[model samples]
Target chain A: MKNKTNTKKGLVKAAFMSFIVVLFLTTTNCSSDGTQIVANFTEIVMQDEFNTEGAPNNALWTYDVGTGDNGWGNNELQYYTDRTENVKVENGYLLITANEEEYNGSSYTSSRLLTNGLFDQQYGRFEARIRLPYGQGMWPAFWLLGENCDEVIWPQCGEIDIMEYRGQEPTKVHGSVHGPGYSGGEAITKTYTLENDRFDTGFHVFGIEWTPDYINYYVDDKLYNQITPADVTGEWVFNQPFYIIINLAVGGSFVGSPNAETVFPQTMLIDYVRVYKN
Target chain B: MKNSKNLYLKKISVVMAILLTTVISCERELSEDAVFAEFGSNAEIYTDAPVGLTDQFFTSFDPNQGANTQGFGTDNNEAYLGSSSIRIDVPQPNDPDGGFIGGIFLDRGQGRNLTGYDALTFWAKGSTTAIIEAGFGTDFSEDKFVVGTKNVVLSTDWRKIIIPIPDESKLIQEKGMFLFSAGTQSTGGVGYTFWMDELKFEKLGTIAQPRPSIFNGEDVVQTAFLGAPVPVTGLTETFNLGSGVNQTVNVAPSYFTFKSSDTNIALVSERGVVTIVGIGSAVITASINGVPAEGSLTVNSGGNFDLAPTPTRDPGTVISIYSDHYTNVPVDFYNGFWEPFQTTESADFIANGDNILGYTNFNFVGNQFANPTVDATVKSNLHLNMYIPDNIPANLDFLISVVDFGADGVDGGTDDLRQQIFFNSSDFVADEWSTLEIPLTLANRSHIGLIIYENVNGSPLTDFYLDNIYFYE
Candidate 1:
């Protein structure tokens, strides 16, 4: 993801976000933790409930096929394929499956879908209600990267991770952001753990509310974390048009390798992905 | 300064990428969550004392065969759970009137409704790491559903052992709650003490992926005769645990619902008894809880059976190896299962309302009686009824051999004696019973241990039936 700084980026987003906050404060609710949650973004610009069967929407999503150079540079073990076995929209859900198989000289296969060219938003609330798969070597994520990634290398273009989960830990998910100096292991990240429940057994909403100055992370209706320029150890690189990428990866630098007990054909189901803007 | 800053940024990019590939990977470890299946029943057998049991739960094995009745009690010093555990002291082989330790924990009331449970779980630790045989589903009256796991090795540290019930659905009211027979076989006949705690039946959902097998999950094909029924062997079930450990337990055939593809050709009962009823091929398969097991029995029936000629020898004068009219002596096995070069299979079955030694794939087989070598010194002649099925081969030379283990009373000893006698092609009558009687010619008949029926010296005898085997004067 690569994006050059725009002169009017901060001023335009600050004005628009405050206007959305004033326009859509009709609903006030208390979360499970008794924290007040006011209606923030109500107008949906892009949404896929996966009500349509077969492949994902062609106009909205595109595939990243085959193993990337050195497993997307993380040494992941699975080949990315657009086959219906790997990814499909069925029964009102989008299923991203990581199967144990031999294809293209890789031991496993999965899918990665991105909206780089079709949909890119400058600032909004992006969330997906997802039920994740479990076991070791399962790394499924819903995140955004700058659309101008070809112009600037990663860490410079910036990345916003709304939800990143290690399947071995069924109860938790991590929210993170990466930029110039604060990237990879040093990225600003926080975790939200569910009580008496697991992400795999049920559907939970993972979202991020982004304005001009800061980003708020949420799992379900509970707001868990906020990251601002002051929180970054490097150059703040969030004022850019970023696109969504949803993927289920197997065995990478982020998740290590799967053991024998890890059952094959793990699946992550997305009930819906809705993006709302002012 | 701009050029130097660009070079520094590039250096950090390379270094951060290295961090991404190595140290970024982390695992959030989860604790063990052993989920038990929800069921209704008093699942506890013993926590500290025997739960839901009468005052005296232990029933000692018969004292006549060296069962030490006084060695079983509860010990409070060691327990996996609660304050006390069942402590058993296994007696040494030289113990007076008691050389072993074993018994059953009988239910004073009616049996337990064990259909809700899947396995009997207990924490066990031995004084010395010794193996024991334990199980349930017996009342010492009609051991109809007895399932014993032989050689359950105990550790020095407390380890939980799970003995899976073959079919819990069958145990609507099971009387026998626990049974254990701990001997000193592994400790070189030396006595040892073992303690068991938290013994109970639990429906552990983690004991999953049941792979029940017959004939060890192999598709075994053989020719069988009409009216002859073959019993299924090697009943077992393997489960993949939550920890990824594969634990296999010996199961009773009653656990499976045996099926014959063509019931007209053959029929397999719930007991896994496959009876050849017609002259066609039928595949026998089994399933438990609608999950198809891996093993199979394919039986190809050979039309009808010709009954063997009945022996007219007087029972008083005969020492029988196998016969319906006389009392057969103690015999070890019908087949020793000598590996590597042996192709003969022993599928002795019940035919025409009586048991028959039906040898199929009849290359060569041995009938061993070495458990108690028959002292046939007073006997004069050996008589056997042999019936050849189908068309007789041109070179049907059946060689019979008798082995006598001299003073050592064991095979392969220096004083062992053997005698081989051949009955040639002219001796057999095809599709009919041939009463062949031979004179006892072995140098020593005092300790006759084994009898072998084989085709040697280029003979090609394949399928045959045998009945009324005895040595008569």
Candidate 2:
């Protein structure tokens, strides 16, 4: 996905403070120029707090099962299963558990959940709060795929990876977009790295504020990267609706195969997923 | 159910609180102009053309010709800068004649002097992804001299397109027409509708060069099998006039002369096709009026150059879905079983022994393996042998999919399942047959229905082949 380094800590602290001030003003329904902030709270178009027990809400999620060639195009080693042992909800969170066990001729087992047909949206604020799993060869992602993927196929259908983390670099996450001229390793990507903490230590918010002409990525409300039409080399295909996907992969192209240091039964805990539109 | 009701009440209360706050703030009035200014200050301006030169092409414009297989009219519902845009509804296979399926013909009765203008700019949007060919054509007939044809991909949102015009001399005809032709649909069905607005010519400050820079393929090592045609199109580039305010004009490849550095290694045709003569390396170059673009081609011998093998499996009792064994059957097996759709069809390269289906440019072949239903659950894997001639360029990929129609029997319904597989030339050995074995367990193969072969990343006009497709336990 993204290939970024680290941001200066001093600048991040200053930006964070400014963000807090803006959030407070906007919530209070006031603008600095003495005018009312219209639509202070964007309408919630879709949400899943994962407060229920047992299975995830069926109305908002579906499952992609089986093992694909080269790990679903990336040469991944995990076999995706719909069973609760691999994917489930508990303690106000959705858990995607990856286990070091053989099943269906694969060396590992994991989960891939999607909102392919149940819920798809065009442009809005898409965000998720997640606690990542750590280890070499672990790959976790929250991404979007165009709804017409079946008809137009990928790259042509467009892809937007809001957040992707490779376990080898536990402190950084990436965001990227893939289309006709730019796809696979050639996609437009940017990395966001934490200053002094690893992503697995706690939960962090990753999001994308998408508009007609721009897509701005954020980590815990701090803007990291922005992509515009000028950044694209081929047809700009993000104008159509896209579906959400959350997957935890094991031993794939991005992070390489798991080694002795890798642990078993790793989990990616997701607190919530929310979409807001104005 | 009780918890859901409680959650609903809590959400409603929060919304009510926000509404109450908004109502209270409404008492402090902001001027209507002030509110508009807040949102409109940074709006993008599309053009600065006076009302006379910018023809919105509302219904008032007369003498518009051509028929759409679906329909066409003035749509007041949407526009780029004005109150309306001309909409053309295109259906599958829209070509009524060799020209555009449908278009609005603007009569330039006596050509207005556009001496200072560098290009034509307009706003367009499509119901689906659409590639439209637009340019200035004289005579409106086969003998018309097209100033320049530019392909533009339109999205659902309105976007501006600038077509640079480098050769003004081609616009000498006193009577000319602005035309647009829709590209053939890659996918089947009802097709899509597109809208155009704010058509005008403008001077964008700098003038374009008379000819554009030649861009041959990137310099790299290439491999071609002994008996296969060398990948030549990758070594050739299309002529496109450079875009932007100041740019150069590109002459078509038809005017360019091509040659190979070593005739003993490879022979370059006038059309830029390089045939591998023997094992070695050669530099291929295309020159137009002395400007040249060069690329390297290497031929490697020793690969399976044999023709496609005859199917060893029996078709009668083995539940064969598609195979060349039935090619000569009298019932026309392809009538309802399989069909191919493509933008352009030419037989320049063969993918396999003389019996497989081949395509050029954006193409898709759909096969209805089982009309009502087929119990493929017993089949563990779906197998297909594909032959991508050396002529297909690198970095370009293709896709194969096995579709399960679910209970609804429709392609894209909610319950339908699709197993899409993507591959490139790197996935196979050059000049040899590659058999792809895809596991059919998770695709709900019990009710397997359709199979589709599509070209995704291949260069336009690159040829590919497919044969011996079936499923087995």
Candidate 3:
């Protein structure tokens, strides 16, 4: 009878251990599907689902060109091509690569896509999942600009950069705001990093919660920076409508020109974009 | 039982001690202001008195004066005043856009007319970097005033500041008093400490006007007429006035051959006007060998020439380089030359009728010198200038004065002044008008050169039009 009791007790212990293991794996693996719902977002176009085909129906995109340097602060060098080679769907992902070649006086090329004509929102939660490229000079930015460009030019139009990673500092990402009282060289920025290896290893979600009184920037779910509109003397740049933009700039005054150490054909893999209005 | 009783006594004593300390500390913090007033026996305290007996000087920053209150727990301190007897405030305003923004200001009813005043002055104590800005308007916008900024180090001391009122011919009709201030929006929109007192306004003196009409009567003729690009030539063409009614085709040479050897001055054509972009004298000889007539042209260092006809002016107004009664020349050699003359500093204007020349000439010049260094409230530091075309004679000397004729307060009036120089044949050629870009560089006080004809001494009767003038950048 004592031997039978021992067996029963041992079996009970084994079952408890198995239950703990299952619980651990289930919790850890489940979070990877982006079910972690970082901050609620108002609008987002996940580029991951379009890996098989470019964003279905070209849902969120606007082409920009012709105006030259005067177009978009006159800092970029591409004609913003829609050609698949410039931007393409491959391996179940939208790949944006920077190329070094001659095109209409400006050398080096890239693609810039915007949700300007497609969607615009005043305030809510905004988040994007992106994997950045690494090298010496690549500048990949996932940001937003005011949609009122005809009435007000850039900077004055307001810009909120959710994730701006310059390859020079491979492991860090910057979130910033550019507007009237503070823009161009006067932009405000803050940097963040992942818990483990640099962000290039895989996709990471970047986000921001934009409300009337405060703007909270986030990495995954970690809040990093907050700015109130009243903190500045200039008009509130965030009060109006704004749309999203994603691009990889080659060389610019702010982000030093790409160097030989930099590698080309780097891809920013976006898992998904989702928005929730509050 | 005895041990337990001892423990209870110990706990009660400890509680009583804690209660006593908290009560004492709170009372002391609350009574700080009372102690501060009496703590320093050696410290001197001055009573608040209205400055500028005419209520021109009111201390709005001092709580003791009863004119205003210091928000955010701030109190009046005598140390905030300046040695000049201007009241001062060292406010500790806390919240952004919520704190007590303090300053001693002068009131000129609605606005003060500084019609006759020659200069402005005040005293200041710098707590961090401070500014002694005097605005001349009851309202913040559309007023012209001067801000004398001083970067002061923190100290338990005092210093005086004096600002020279530049171009008093325009500022005196100031209908406002001085402003001794701290906590401007520039200080991170936060609080700063500045002490001022003994506000005094003394007329330093008037600005003397320079003599005008320095043009030496030599006519400058454009050797090249307005036309298409051509091969190099040795002689230039001249125009002929038809003498009789039938002399319609009394044609003259339509082109001139310029000697390549005299290429010291590079001449470019915009429409038909010939611009000399060189420093040395180039002989642009246009010789009509048959009649044997000759004219000489000299180019000066860093200068431009205008061949257009002057604007029609009021017949009686003295027509010289500094005449306000006339308009600017029809053309602006520099963009935005009309900015300085307009009543409104806003860069607003309608693009008007097309000029005989293709370029669009707005009735008003666009904005120049985006940020100015003077007062933005009382009087605009607008030294208005108009371009005038004068007929060149052998040699003539003229007088130029900077004068103003306006109301002492808000009533509008005229204030004018002229800077004089001499022009000789060696300086500028005649028949063609000379355009002098004023306030030469982006500087507050720039060089104003006049051709003071050292030889001739009378103003000529020939009419010249002045148009499109401004403070050049």
Candidate 4:
């Protein structure tokens, strides 16, 4: 009987030890935070210098069937495609090129990248260093949208435009935010110029820091705009997880339809992306 | 018994420790959120007012005036040189392309400047209808220009329209005006009877007008501007020597004549700064190289002033509101107006209020005016309305105002101008309907309203049409 009691006590002690071991392992691997260190997950998933033929690997993005007949609400000419000419990673950078072609019903072709199912985050910093195209009618953008966008409409789901530009103004880049109350023409935006050559010549950094309180946009390290809680009056669509999107759209509403002056094969180059947390 | 009790206690203690660790770790993880920053540089805002044609401050609309020449209208029949030197017209068969043609030029001089003063106002009126159009160009070839331009719809009864060029810094300023190519090029379109009058350029007055170039001599004027050299600094240094750098480039030799190389006496750098290289003094043509660009420079011995002085005209004043708050607001008749209405789902009425324009010069009291409402989002057949008061006169003059106020009072305000228009009411309506079609270039996605004040003689009437006013950047 005494022996039986001893065995029972020993079993209980063994169970307790196992539980403690598992708890310690979890704490060490995850730090004090609940997020486990994703071995290969880095802030930047892709970068292209346009120095080579194709864009970086794993840059597989999706197309949005725009709000209207045009590709999205922009009424842009270029249709997003998976072809190497539309997008490629080479020469140490990623390139989204707009070429004159017939695809879907549009006369122009380009590539759009999105981390939709590949990578997404609830709240984090995202940025892309890119070089813009020149001339009239060309448009380039790096932005973010809510992950569950299929269920929700645009602007209503919220959009964080880290960078946008037109070929007419080859030297300047704009950062903005759009939502239900302040979408489209009323979007909050600020412009920044390039430090080196024109945007078409070399790559420049375009980034955004989105949080519950505010959103900060930058060109290189220069902070051009900040969107506070007060800036948003509609649904707090930004609170949910969002994925990254990179695209080069042909002429649409803001830049107007591409005219004859606009040259084909306009390219946008993207460099590395890095993210840090406190 | 005591040992068993102790064992149970140990088990409980371990469990509690594990739970505590798990909770703390989760809290820590929350702090490590991801955020990102953008990259780029800032361009300096050039607010300095330009003075001479030799100044590197203008970009020409057409560099190579080829076959069709840089004119207005569409591809098939453009408005080229007409019998009268001042007019460019659209050949009949009026399609979208072959309409009117106009151009502006910039002359690269001492400074790397191409844009113009902030405010640009001109006096223009149509001989026939109130429909006139305008666009900016960079090259003479139809392929290199910004086409599909719409007019501001000026009055046929002799009125003045003023427009403040947007982001002058973004303009190819070397030498350009806000170019207008009026009259419809659409098929079955009635030819244009409009004539643009007195176009003038003025410098925006600030603390001190940046000092003008000190001298104007046959010899290249030596200058030391305050800022660093620009992208295209010197016309002589940048151009190919084989292309006539050793000859004189006429500034304002004549309006429509293509400049020719005489003695290789003139040279300019890509920076736009010019230098007289040889002896003979020929007119050094200065030109702005982008849409609505213009430039004139003449250099000769004995310091002869061959430079054609810019025409003088009235400063830019406001025009009448096209349409806003469609209900109970008066739309101008003499000036002519077009406001389409639409029905859509998002157009439901809310308690807060509708969009209204509010600039420093204008304001509104909350609830003082009843909220104007719009319909929901829809595809086709949706529309809004604007009413032109039947009380309009045969001849008229006025300014328009509009605003769209958003919730935070940040961008909501009046004075949202889409384009600059020039017209007269008499040409459109001798005694009957004053029909005019004007285009709103930057109307989408903006939060603002309109205000129309009649300076000559008029009163507010409540009728207008509107539709499909959405927001976009």
lDDT of 3 by residue, B60-106 (tens): 44543222244212224433232123333444445433344444344
Model 2: per-residue Cα lDDT over B1-473, one tens digit each = 69976875786678666666666689875443331111001111122222321263211212223334345565766666545676776655535532235443544233444444556668899998767666553334442334444457788998876666544434443233355666454335446788877776665432222233333344544454344554344322232222112222233334356677777777766544656666666766665445565444444433335556666655543445656564421212222322233443432343244445444333665667445656677777777776665554666567878888787766666988888888876777655677887877555666667777767755342455566677766
Model 3 chain A, poorest ten-residue lDDT window? A34-43
Residues A178-209, model 2: lDDT tens digits: 99999999999999977645677689999988
TM-score of 2: 0.35
Each model's fraction of native contacts: 0.00, 0.00, 0.00, 0.00
Give the residue spans of candidate 4 off by over 4 A.
Answer: A1-55, A59-69, A193-197, B1-473
Best by TM-score: 1
Per-residue C-alpha lDDT of model 4 across residues B208-322, encoded as one tens digit per residue: 1111110122123221111111111112101101111111111211112223143355444432333444445444333332222123234332211111122121212112122
Between candidates 1 and 3, the one scoring higher on lDDT is: 1
lDDT of 1 by residue, B253-350 (tens): 77788889998999887777888888889999998777788889888888777667667777899999998778899888887766436777776766
TM-score of each: 0.66, 0.35, 0.31, 0.34
What DockQ class does candidate 3 belong to? incorrect
Compared with the real two-chain complex, what DockQ does model 4 have? Answer: 0.01
Instruction: Supply the TM-score for candidate 1.
Output: 0.66
RMSDs, each prediction?
Answer: 17.7, 27.2, 29.0, 31.6
How accurate locally is residue B130 in candidate 3, as Cα lDDT from 0 to 100?
A: 44
Model 1, residue A260: distance off in Å is: 7.6
Among the numbered candidates, top DockQ falls to 3
- Model 4 lDDT, full chain set: 0.45
lDDT of 1 at B187: 89
